[model samples]
Target: MKHVLAIGAALVLAAGVANAEEECLEVGSPVGAFYVADVTGPSAGTKLCYRCKFKDRPVVSIFAREVNDQVAGLVKQVDGVVGQNQDQKMAAFVVLLTDEPESAEGQLKTVAEKHGIQNTPLTTFDGVAGPASYKLPKDADVTVMMWVDGQLKVNESLKFGELSDSKVSAVLGDTEKILN
Candidate 1:
């Protein structure tokens, strides 16, 4: 009876901790945040957020679908490094923001022609805080984000501090709202 009681107590405690973590938007793995976006499908591999800690461990993977071949290819590449919890099994398209509004608009139209995605712009006017918007297929699974550097980027700025120009790579600052 005592053992059973102890097990029950442990389970309760575990559940509480899990709940707390789920609600703790800021506290999550190095990969994209679990509670950030409405991620669906297979799962993304290990992703690295800017504010992630060294000891962070991945817990979930978000795999969006409906993107073009380019988007799917990017997702597969990124997920490959996410290790165990990677949601690579998932597939999808992702809208990508451009380095600049004009270029983004153009690319959206071009990519759409080949991939059949409709481009949409996020038109950022926050003045050095947000990125100008570009549109892609609404169902794209690739993680479309912005690069404050304008028009083009050498790398995807997953971490906030990496923004050299007053650019934002995506709709989110961190994993905080990506899962929404």
Candidate 2:
């Protein structure tokens, strides 16, 4: 029974490792520019490349398939962080990846207003796959990438139902890695 339990534990651990390794954009990788239609923020209704705008600044980019309560809460928290770190030129944006960009824009706008998300722009990509360069995993419901000087410092991928409060806090904490 003990040997059997050990094998089961090893399998579970291996599965977790595999999932972690599947995250989009490895650390230290260069982040390229990608355009998304800005639903809310300074450039509302315009398609723009946030990467180009925030060049060399510490940035947190979130790509999510759907907007849920958890995602809204995460965005709100990230917005607050961005507001507090303006002196550091820390920036962040949320990209909603959907097949229907038009409807996604409305949903993003609603989330921004409801959550008072002033610092983070809520944007939408054309499809659920996200930008071709991103190579976002099909199983990933949300992918958060933080970079400084255009080099990625942190990359986290969470599947549906995986974005808990603790996970949000962990992601926020990792922002320090790029802020320097």
Candidate 3:
């Protein structure tokens, strides 16, 4: 009876450990690739793969279908985070996932100018596949994703008017922890 009880307890402990291991994998699944024009860069019209652009630094990506106050605030918030952490190798990308990406270019440029976003890049992709590659939902107004050292560290989906400073800070803090 003692032997059977010990074996049963060990099996339960092993199961717990296995579940914990799988939890990490579930969050860090690989993202697909897509290309976009870097509207804010010196070579403004040049196109590049979204993933390859920020593979080296910790990336904060905000995927929004439309630019609302929430999206603007979140982008500015993340731009500040990246600014403060410039020495730590950080980057932010605002990905506008719209049907008519070209038409939104002027508006995105205006938003970037308004926010004085120096650290983050403001841009848009061609199709829905861009956000889909990041595993973002269609209805979600903003999805904030962070990747550090080529690993997807944080993936947060926020609705309009839902982002707060504390939440953005926590994500930045968590990614910083990964670096250390």
Best by lDDT: 2
The global Cα lDDT (0 to 1) of model 1 is 0.29
**Span of 10 residues, lowest total lDDT, candidate 3:** 20-29
Better of 1 and 2 by TM-score: 2
Ranking by lDDT: 2, 3, 1
- Put down candidate 3 lDDT per residue, 116-169, tens digits, no spaces: 877778888877545444656555677777777667777777667566677666
lDDT of 3 at 173: 68
Candidate 1 lDDT tens digits, 100-173: 43334343345434433221111211122221122222332332332211111112323323322333323222
Using lDDT as the measure, name the better of candidate 1 and candidate 3.
Answer: 3
By TM-score, who's the top model here? 2
lDDT of each residue in 5-116, candidate 2, tens digit only: 9999999999988886754567888889999999998999999999999999999999999999888999999999999999999999999999899987778888999999
Instruction: Write down the lDDT that model 2 would get.
Output: 0.91
* Residue 107 lDDT, candidate 3, scale 0-100: 90
**TM-score of every model versus the real structure:** 0.22, 0.87, 0.76
Please state every model's RMSD to the true fold in angstroms.
17.8, 4.7, 7.1
Supply the TM-score for candidate 1: 0.22
lDDT of each: 0.29, 0.91, 0.73
Ranking 2 against 3 by TM-score, winner: 2
